[model samples]
Target: MATIASQIILHPVVSQGLKFGGTTLGRDKTYRALQYFSRFFAWYLINKGDKIEAARWSALKAHLGTARKLMRLGKPMEHLQAALRAAFSSSPALETITTIARQLGYFGYLSYDAIVWASTIKLINVTKETAARVQKRAFQFWVAGIAFSLIHGALKSLRLAKESKALKASKTWGEKDLAEEASRETRVAQITAARNSNNAQLALDIFDVWIPASGAGLVNLSEGTLGIAGLISSLLGAKAQWQSVNGKK
Candidate 1:
């Protein structure tokens, strides 16, 4: 029994999960996954005519959302700092502009969202209409941020494609360039990895945009659809964070 318990405690997956859960972002991602799952389950329950169960799930989703909002209360300043750093980055003009814009959009969104959260908890007093307007504005900024992220991802993909083409074309050269073959192969691998990462991020943003768009009234996605989308994106984000935590390539 002791041996079995030690083995279980020392399992790699368990160790990795503990490391992952140690970070604020990881915890947030876990909560986000649960929140979206609750949303989807609630919708499923509703469709099955189980109003009592659906209400419980719906309440869980709402509470998770509120908790996430509280957790992100300090994020606006972080985004602002990121925007400032992006403004002075040596990246290409379009890339730099889009990066700054995206960061600023997130900064604005989180700032307004903090206010909405405060109003919700009565930490700050505001009329219902005012709160709704503030929440809508926050979603609008979120939509803008996701839009810019998509654009940035597209541009990055194009750039990587061009680099990949050039690298492949070099492979056909004669023995004169044979000495650099290994270097070229390494660069090609890096480019491929970058393209994959960029595509994954693009997909995540694409799925996530609908939630904010719906909140802002720019789109009318069903709650079930939004829930599934959010769940997918949250998993994607969690995977990325897991890789980071595990130092995986």
Candidate 2:
């Protein structure tokens, strides 16, 4: 039977719902909620042993601006996929990596909101007050989003590399040693799972206690509340999976 994590990753209703609800709330809230949920969703997919899907999903989420630009430029989205595949090849050449990185750089430069704001200023007349505050906010949003994407990608890559190295090292052990190592790893995993369960319970408890005090101060309380609830739900779901793995009730 498929695991709950697998079901969630494959269906993605929870993530999609959060995105839709967040967008309805406000642009700022939408991206904030999305940035958080993407991390959670990526974790869920990885837990389900769908690391490739997780990576692709992470890439897509990080490159929405690139997607938008592809639409504007009449380029197919598959082009980016091909570029990424080539860039990530086991024996990728320096030129291939450079090309992909350059493309990403160009996309970031052209589609960034700061550049868009400047273009808008040149093409359309607006009050000075509107230009100063509103456009500046737009520029900030784009820069922050790009920075977040870079950091997220870098961290995920590092984690994957470490895991790969560990797996490769394990392969060098003899059969008996490998079996013993696997058993040891399994026990450690169980302890880790139990710890995760405790952490999740603590998080849910704190969220429940804090919601009443914090909810009143939030702008767009209903939407914000939904976003928070969604985040808590995902945490609880992961906790449940960990508990199940560890044979905990």
Candidate 3:
């Protein structure tokens, strides 16, 4: 029994999980996954005529959302810094513009979202109408950010595709040029990886966009649909973050 316990304590998965949960973002992702699951379960319960259970799940979802808002209190400035960095990046003009726009949109969304949070907690009293307006504006900015992100992803994918094709078409003279060919192959591989990452992000943004659009009254997705979409996007984000934390490709 002692040997089994020691082995469990020293397991690699256990260690990696601890490392993952140590970061703020990792914790938020976990919460988000739970939150969205709650949302979906609440809807399912309601359809089954279980009002009490549905109410409990709904409350859990709301509380988790409030916790996430608190966690992101100072995050707007991070988006602002990202915008500035994007402005100075050596990307093409359209990509740079879209990237900066996306970051700035996030900055605006988070700034307004902070105000909504403060009002919710009674840190500063705002009328219900005002709070609703602010929330709508925040969701609007979120939609814009996702739109720009999709554009950026499309442009990046196109650029990477061209680069990959060109690299593949390049000819090597002989053994002397073998090293250059190998270098070209490496660059092509890097491009492919980057394209895959971009594509994944694009899919995540696509799934996420509808939730904000519904909030902004631009669309009317069912609660269950929004819940499932949010869950999928959160998992995608968590996967990317996990790879980053573990130094994996």
Candidate 4:
């Protein structure tokens, strides 16, 4: 990525006909530095609260100030021209910095229960509201996963049993033929059950691990969306479990 940045900084002749208050800042090495400084300054203004952002801005400003002093510029135009050149030239760097800052900010702002759960299952120990919310979400994911598995398992088992009975009735089968058909059906049923279980496990991992870790940041979707989804899945899973329990009774 740094190599990419260097390539862009060197190759792109972004600085063209650049003038600040009638003072020409020609496209050259100095001009590129000036551009970088200016762009960094703008980025600082946009993301000023963070300590790192402030420190970087201060360093960049000081460098530009030092350059100004060395140039012995009495006119404001000379300083303005230099600053403008830096701002325009440093766009690539500024964009990269901004993106990184945003990701860091998002990480700090969000709660991730997966980490907490991995460390320990004691959700009550986590005091933060965000942590609590994340724990609830994780639990919902588990419940949903279970609910789907139970309901799906029951339905699929019933379906296979019915199909087996039908096959037996349709065939004038000897004991050996009936036994072979039953074995084949059992194998099919086992494979299907395993596949469905794996699917449920995948769903659980997505909601519990993937979403909390990084997926949330990548999508930039509202946290409320996850909350709503968690709620629905929890309900479905609970209902399925309840029905299964009642059916067994």
Task: Tally clashes: model 2.
Answer: 0
Q: Which digits, one per residue and each the tens of the lDDT, describe model 4 over residues 40-145?
A: 4545455545766656655664455345333333333433444446456533454334333333333322223234443344434656766656655544443333
Which candidate do you rate higher for TM-score, 2 or 4? 4
What tens digits encode model 2's per-residue C-alpha lDDT throughout 109-216?
A: 334444344444365566776655554454343333334334434444444455545655665457868877787577556645544444554454444332322322
Candidate 1 wrongly placed segments (more than 4 Å): 172-179
Q: Is 2 or 4 the stronger prediction by lDDT?
A: 2
Q: Answer with 1 or 2, whichever has the higher lDDT.
A: 1
What's the number of clashes in each of the models? 0, 0, 0, 7
C-alpha lDDT values of all predictions: 0.94, 0.48, 0.93, 0.43
Ranking by TM-score: 3, 1, 4, 2
Task: Indicate whether candidate 2 or candidate 3 has the larger TM-score.
Answer: 3
TM-scores of the models, in the order given: 0.95, 0.24, 0.98, 0.28
Off by over 4 Å in 3: none
Alpha-carbon deviation at 99 in model 4, angstroms: 34
- lDDT score, candidate 4: 0.43
Q: Which candidate gets the maximum TM-score versus the true structure?
A: 3
Error of 4 at 216 (Å): 7.2
Local error of candidate 4 at residue 135 (angstroms):
10
lDDT (tens digit, per residue) of candidate 1 on 78-108: 9999989988888788888888889989998
Better of 3 and 4 by lDDT: 3
lDDT of 4 at 57: 56
Give the Å error, residue 122, model 3.
0.9
How far in Å is the alpha carbon of 18 misplaced in model 3? 0.7
Clash list (residue pairs), candidate 3:
none
